[model samples]
Target: MLPEFPMSRQCPYHPPAGYEELRKEGPLAQVRLYDGRTAWAVTGYDETRRLLVDPRLSSDRSRPDFPVLVPRMAAAKLVALVGMDPPEHDVQRRMLIPSFTVKRVNSLRPAIRRIVVERIEALTADGRRAADLVPEFALPVPSTVICELLGVPYGDHEFFEEQTRRMLMATSTAQEAAAASAALIRYFEELIETKLGEPGEGLLDELITERLGRGELTREEVASIAMFLLVAGHETTANMIGLSILTLLEHPGRLARLRSDEGLAAGAVEELLRFLSVADELQRVAAADIEIGGRLIREGDAVYLPNAAANRSPEAFPDPDVLDLERGTRHHLAFGYGVHQCIGQNLARAELEIALYELAVRLPELSLAEPVSQLGTKPGGSVQGILRLPVRW
Candidate 1:
């Protein structure tokens, strides 16, 4: 039996580089959450994937004895959209997925390209030996594009992004984090009101006029959807951009190939998403007693599927940790697997392709100022990727 882990000291997002040590011991491990709760982490790929799509893994922890990492109120509020079981989750996810399909994002490709191009050009024009690409380029391109796609005004983005950062990081206190979430709801609350008065030619507008008119969503549901998009679209893409830069710079040969051959760009993004896998571990709880990896799980036990670990699972991928762009990178689970895979994956790909293509082509000399081992993560527990990535053209 594995030893008991004290949760009060563990920050799953910042677990040490040797995490696979614990994971390899078994698919299931007793671990500590930041709040010191006793929860289980499910680390095996086959078993983890099964549990994610398992109907019994309840996402709603609002029940008095709800299964989760935090208290009912906080967990439900943070994961309300992604955490709900189906019928409830199915309807909400369906309403949002159409807006993020490849067709829709492809239509916005030229616009994504334009946004990416402008930022890279600005960085190149500065002509510095090193550039803080995180804010200068990575952060803004996705922030503004998603806003336009969602029909939010540019002025509102700065505020939204600030509040999101606070919400994502541990930089803020619990009270501070709550306030930021409330402020965002207020902003989205106001946006929903405006869209009601005069709808525009964007996803959120169409969602309101067409769906709400047809009784597809409630007013609160609309606000929740808008809130979900704003948080996910910006932060996930921002990290991808920042992490991809770090990934390429960490491997100059791959960077050179992308710079020299435009054909490598698409495959490279997939490879980077696979290699970096910044989304890291995803969680689910066992609904009832089930046998996995030959061990029986009791009902209500929480499971943590470390996608980063699984993507690097040697059994699943040959020599898994290597960053091989030409390795026919199709089987990786960066976007996840089965029913609960990322809904915004298509949009994320579009944004990454546009941003990365422009950066590689324009900044032919793009390289990192510091090694990957040295950078710190952004505060708050929400987003964790290569935090401060410096680059040069």
Candidate 2:
């Protein structure tokens, strides 16, 4: 019998133990999902990179054969870039590329640094002995940056954040997820109209004044893009920030090195990203028949790429399980690969570098307020993140 896909990890920082057996079996192997459907699980580094960039595969969630890693993920209609294929995906991605370029993202470093410092001050503002890093620090840095970048009112963050959480949680009922999705759609629709009339100096305004006005994109498309940006902008990076901090805390030697040497900051971020492939899986559907790993995948077949498995494959990096700050990790799939690769990666990289550096410098004596095993994580979610990171300095 084939091992099941989407296996739960015994430990939060690693992939499920079954992945080792699967990897040893072959690059691609058949596995059953919770829905009782059989799909191909891509586990090897070479196969994963190939399949991610393969044009024969479609990211379209609307496709009948699209792999639904979790039932809740399939409940919503395909509206974001993750669910769109070429031509459509190409057009939408092009419009938003300028704002996320390395130069543009670097320009916000000063502001991101300020946000990090401010959040740290706020975390200790009341002279509290301990604080939850998730909400207080991780969540706020990216949330504030994305809000300021898109001109979204930071005041409305709580509502949208909660709604987004519900939508992504695998345990959420279809009805609940759908309702949250509807609320976000409604919110963005209204916001788009407001930006249309009196444009602000943000990505949303640029989309309105440039893309929509030039007929390059429709109003609904702009709204969908905005919704995508708002959710993707903060959630993934926040989770990563929390996870990175926890990982560093677990390795005091590395943490001490980071504090002592500023040059290691960038490489450390990449290494942490590699060490923890936060997203459990990347789903795709074969748009046409294709042969991979000496096996033929028919058109309309589902494929699931377990990033955690691929990232940890010894074939890609020796001693894959170990986290080395000096490791050559530029090839990590934490941000993904191919045309669907994360567009906001530049922004994320900047946030991680600055956030980690500030924490090292300002809170040199920071330590977990509670035992590591006592911490909670979001179960049954695509993005793996700490639920709460209690810490004290």
Candidate 3:
């Protein structure tokens, strides 16, 4: 029998066990999803990379045959840039490039550094035995940064974060997901309207003053993009921050080595991304018939490109399961590859580098407060991470 799609991970730090068998099956294998639909699971590194950039594959979720990873995705309208192709995708992506440029992201380094420091200070300030790192540090740094960047009040984070959680949770019901989506859309609409005349210092304000104000894009488009930024910017990094710390804590000698040599922060960040690959899979649909490794994927066939499977492939990385900070090769699909690669990766990298380095320096004695088996794992989500990470110095 084919393995169930979105197979559960045996452990938080490991890929789903079924992925190992799928990789051995060949570059491509079939999988059955909860909806009783079968999709082609691309398990090989080379094939997954090739198909990610293939024009014959479509990211458009509107297609009736498009693979829906979660209920929220299935309920979503094909309105966001993620669901666009070619000219439309290119145009929308270009508008947001200015905010995500290497220079622009690098310029925020000091702010990110400050954010990390402040979070660490707060975490260590309270005279308590231990604290949940997820709430204490991980969730706040990115949430505050993105909020300040987008001109959204940090006070509203609870409303949006809860909604985003509902929308992304794999177990979310259709009604719950739809309501969350509706709430976010409504919030963005009101926020965008407020920014029209009196622009703020955030990205949304810039979009309003420069693009929307000049009629370059519709109000709906600007709001949609802002909503996308809110969810994508904070949630992924927040999860990574919490989970990466847990992974590092599991390897104490490595953690000590990193603390001793601060220069390893960048390499460690990349290594963590390659090893964990929080965004486990990239979903697509074959736009046209394409032959891959002796298997022909028919048009409209759903394709599941799991990054965890490829990142852990022996063909791609020797001792793939081991996390080596000095692993010379940094080519991993953590943020994905091709034209659709993550736009905020530079920013995410900066945050991780700063957070991990300073955490080690500030709390060198940091250890897991809870047993490894006791750590709470968020069971079903496109992004795999811990719900709460308890730690002590």
In model 1, which residue pairs have backbone atoms overlapping below 3 Å?
Answer: 7-32, 42-304, 169-379, 169-380, 170-379, 170-380
Residues 25-51 of candidate 1 have per-residue lDDT tens digits of: 677667665555556666676776777
Q: Please, what is the TM-score per model?
A: 0.90, 0.97, 0.97
lDDT of 2 by residue, 1-393 (tens): 666667766666777788888877789888888788888988898899999999999998777777777777766543678889898898889888999999999899999999999988887777866788998989988999999999999999999889888888777877887888888889988988887777788888888888889998888888888888999898889889999999899999999999999899999999888888886688888989989887788898888888888899898999999989999569988778999999999999999999998998889889999887688766644578778899989
Task: Determine which window of 10 residues in candidate 3 has minimal summed lDDT.
Answer: 71-80
- Over all chains combined, what TM-score does candidate 2 have? 0.97
| Residue 325 miss distance in model 1 (angstroms) | 0.8
Give the lowest summed-lDDT range of ten residues in model 2. 71-80
Better of 1 and 3 by TM-score: 3
Q: Which of the two, 1 or 3, has more lDDT?
A: 3
**Number of clashing residue pairs, candidate 3:** 0
- Ten-residue region with minimum lDDT total, candidate 1: 5-14
lDDT of 1: 0.71
Give the per-residue lDDT digits (tens) of candidate 3, residues 290-389.
9997799999888889998999988999999999998967788888888889888988998899999999898878899888778767664467898779
